[model samples]
Target: MNAPYLLPAMLALAVGTYALRWTGPAMRHRMRLSPRMIHLLDTGALILLAALVATTALPAGTDHLGLALPTGVAVGGVLAWRRVPLLIAILAAAATTALLRLLGVQ
Candidate 1:
């Protein structure tokens, strides 16, 4: 937390992160992933993304989950799955959330 150590710490972290990012591409040609491993990784990514969405959409400090946020997210997800433009999907989600809230659906 000291001011003097902050710069050095940040630099070290940045270098480490860069090295990690570079490692994957640098080793990609040398390393081979099995089909099962690839499938697992894809599934893991989807699961993580879903978890992030759930946590972000769920209301805080509440005993019961609200319908508006999840409904909006579902609408966005459906649009995205149908290959709709990202901006439109996002705007539709926001509009859905606003309308639900205005209708006192929380």
Candidate 2:
């Protein structure tokens, strides 16, 4: 929310996206993973994905959001786990958060 930080944040995000796009193909020729290694990599990716979500949902430091984020995340996670389409799951989560906030939930 800091105006002065926006450019730096956007630049960082762009760099991160660029890195993610480039890293796999860039290193692909350097190593070949075994099946077990592939599985572990997949699992590690999933864990990192979850960790990112958790951090966003339950933020630390100064600008504290609230429990509504995590509650909505749980709803979204259940829908996703039940094989709901990605868009629907995301909308459901957003709706949940909005409704909770409207109802004065912290």
Q: Pick the candidate with the highest lDDT.
A: 1
Q: What lDDT would each prediction earn against the true structure?
A: 0.85, 0.84
* Cα-lDDT of candidate 2: 0.84
Model 2, 1-106: lDDT tens per residue?
Answer: 8999999999999999999999989999998889999999888966765786677677777486777888898788777666789799899999998899999997
Cα lDDT of candidate 1 equals: 0.85
Error of model 2, residue 35, in angstroms: 2.6
- TM-scores for candidates 1 onward, in order: 0.65, 0.55
For residues 1-106, could you state the per-residue lDDT of candidate 1 as single tens digits? Answer: 9999999999999999999999999999999999999999988966765676677677578788789989998787677666689799889989998899999998
Question: Each model's RMSD to truth, in Å?
Answer: 3.6, 6.1
RMSD of 2: 6.1
The 10-residue segment of model 1 with minimum total lDDT is 48-57
